[model samples]
Target: MTPAQIIQAIEGMEPAMQRAYLEQVKTVVGAATVAEVERLIADEDEDGLVALLSLGALSVFLELARSVFIAGARFEVKAISIPRDLGRFEFDARQPAAEQWVSAKAEEIRANATIDVRAAVREVMGRRRRAVVWPAAQQVQVSATPMVRTPRQSALDLLGRVSAQTGSRSGGVIGLPGNYAQYVLNARAQLLGGNPDEMRKYLQRKRRDRRFDGIVNRAIKAGTPVAQADVDKIAGRYADRLMKTYAEMLSKAEALESFGAGRDQVYEQLIAQGLDRDSVTKTWRDRGDKKVRHTHSVMGGQEVQKDQPFQSPAGALLRYPGDTSLGAGWSERANCRCSAIYKIRRK
Candidate 1:
């Protein structure tokens, strides 16, 4: 049957049957129409698409006619009344009362959970590609290597290779450890070492109380009693820290999947966990935030204080098990201190 006929069928169905009819249409027509419905579902300036689908309204008939003309299955779309956001609470012209203000903010938080399921469906459809596996040969070679690196080291090596191949100048790039200021500063303390470019930059600045001279002397002073084992241990520790931090953030964002949350829900939960809500507000409010934002559903939040004894951040990331998202999100506004970490998969 044509799309219009299916829509007409939906309109004619009793309220009890409307939802069921829609589902059946999905089965019959396949999922491709999800995109078209999404395009039409939220159009404001256009005439009432939702009202037309009403059982009493002839709009349903008209819509079904259109669908039939296009030779597509008909379906009904429902309005989801999500809570309004409270984060944007303003005491401005409306002068909403304090309770109203709070409610508004809360509602806003709830509203953020709103999502176009079709968007996800579209993404899934577009991403229908086979999984990747490191070849068995590669795994065998890795096993034979002299050093049995932990999973963390393996990940770091992979990251380094990715950075090298992609020529990424980002802070986390592997080989150029000194590109990061923290590592560079540590190197000056003679506790770490990094890429020459990074080291040179740190060296150009004046040293405090000839500290650099002292470090250089320590390096060259004959019989200074440097222990190769100690140096290896220290460097290894630094690498461990970097890998741990990266992995922890990455794992938390990955956890976002379990919650099946919409964008706003993610913002609220993350904010409660210690992320600055306002920061996420600004990002989501803008046109460009979606590309940079991602989510992880970690078990812990900001409640886990810095002084508190805890496992690595990776453990914390797994503390929460709700929903999360990656990509530029309306949720990751400015002043949002939440870091959404993720990696890309080539399909």
Candidate 2:
């Protein structure tokens, strides 16, 4: 029979016969595809329990929920100020002790910072998973037994699976999704050793000022040779500033990663529930501010299939903002305020 004729013939069958025929089709297409087809068929059956289900409504609800979650889920890292007395050392540029002291202080800062950021990211991720998954589960209507409350351990295990790293750059660490954990770690390392150009410029300008000169002269006159105490004081001040800057950068990056991960998790669950990947589309939305990168600003409103990546003006391809999977560099991913909006097409 022709394809249309076969569909008509199947429709004419009694419900029991239709199910039996579905089983036969299942043997051919495999369980997953057949499951999806059954869901679509149920969606179209006006008298079927699935007719009461609304995937479109669920999509809308999830979209709104994710948007709100992304907007509100800002993880702030507290500024870590190195104590002045934390690593006091005698002034000697040639001494290894000076280097050791600096190294120790940086290690302490990194350890403390990592702990704070990780805890905050995990907490946000927990909330995000719940916000996306549970609601979708409740909305899904199936002929099988009603969805049971997943045991806490089971839920965590599932999340662990979902959060597994897909490749070198994608997935891993629940809320700090993708290469975000590594990104933050790298940033912290850089913050300690790399002299930021902005900081260098600020220091240069400060050194040219008369007030800075006076401070150095006073330190020398106070029996502190070569103004070692003054040097430490200046270093401490800038260290605090840089730490604050790093904290802000980390908070913003985590928010973006968490948002992307949460969105991906929700759609993944829907796909598992038989939603067709082809029926979904994701759109890029730039925050529409001067702070947005020029390349991303031009990408605003770009739409593509859910499985495809969006190409930025600079030729960076990303599954979503802050996505490093496609080789998007720090310039493209850092402090990105862009958002992904998903749409689902229902028959």
Candidate 3:
């Protein structure tokens, strides 16, 4: 399966598993989103609401990110030929230097997850605030104690899961590194899209949440009589919408969070097993925009344009996930679901 397919499969898991997964997230941001709405109704604390939203976003992000990494790892092994048996990655450790590189790179990416997740969390928080002019919580703190795993825990947890994935589901595809190499390419897309993915979802949900808060807060602060129905709408009606939106967003974001930080480990594994500079070629998707960004569109295929998104021997487009390789700044990242395809050439 392509990274895109893997992302879809994970997002479209059994309903029961999906519910179980979300129940975990609700313990953090899900509940907070509701409580903050109530707080706005009761205490008229706009800043507190914003802070809560930010914290809630952080919590959601951490959980989503962890899920993405695990899903990506699982897909990596299975993407190639399914192993005759499941347990023990088919990694060839013949090249000590390559193996070492993979291990070190994985750690490096894992460590960087905290920074990336935090930044994405803040972007969501800030975007939500801007949408409704949600005031600063005289004490806006994004980390009201993350409801889910701490960012670091989430990162480490991803690495652990990837290790488990390798042990349990890889082996047999000797000298065939397309799956491993593709995993890295796909993961970079996942990592790059994380911030925008969550931010878009937050922006949509909070736009409505805060809008409701504004209406109720206005009536309450003005000593205006809020209709009983209005009160109910504020607390219950929109809460349902918030959750529905959240579920949708979770699916979308996780698809993007399908992951990051584990690219190093994946790359090294591929290299140790014989992947090389020419092993993975990064290709662009031609959206066929009459006016497309030079970065991705310049490549010029019916599916890709010409002369953009520089490609290096290392892999597909020189640009990784977070870079503005798309050119319209971060907005391009949000809309560009374009993927990195990995093809292997062997003598």
TM-score of each: 0.21, 0.40, 0.40
**Which runs of model 3 end up more than 4 angstroms from their true locations?**
1-7, 13-67, 81-228, 231-236, 259-265, 285-330, 333-337
Question: What would the per-residue lDDT of candidate 1 be over residues 205-261, giving only the tens digit for each residue?
Answer: 432223334443453333132233433333333433443443333222221221112
- The TM-score obtained by model 2 is 0.40
Higher-ranked by lDDT: 2 or 3: 2
Candidate structures ordered by lDDT, highest first: 2, 3, 1
Cα-based RMSD of the predictions, in order? 25.6, 31.8, 16.4
Q: What C-alpha lDDT, on a 0 to 100 scale, does residue 292 get in candidate 1?
A: 28
lDDT of 2 by residue, 1-347 (tens): 12233222222322332233223222222212323423433343322212221111222222332342232221110111212332432222223432343344335333443453344334323332342111222233322232222333222211222212331111112222223333332222222222233223333433133345455444323422223233333433333233334434543443354345444444544455456778778888876779889999999999999889999888999887766557776688666767776677664
lDDT, each prediction: 0.27, 0.41, 0.36
What lDDT does candidate 1 reach at residue 216? Answer: 34
Candidate 2 residue runs with Cα over 4 Å from true position: 1-226
Residue 236 Cα positional deviation in candidate 3, in Å, after optimal superposition: 4.8
User: What is the C-alpha lDDT profile of model 3 across 56-84, one tens digit per residue?
Assistant: 33334344444554554555555554223
Q: Candidate 1, TM-score vs. the true structure?
A: 0.21
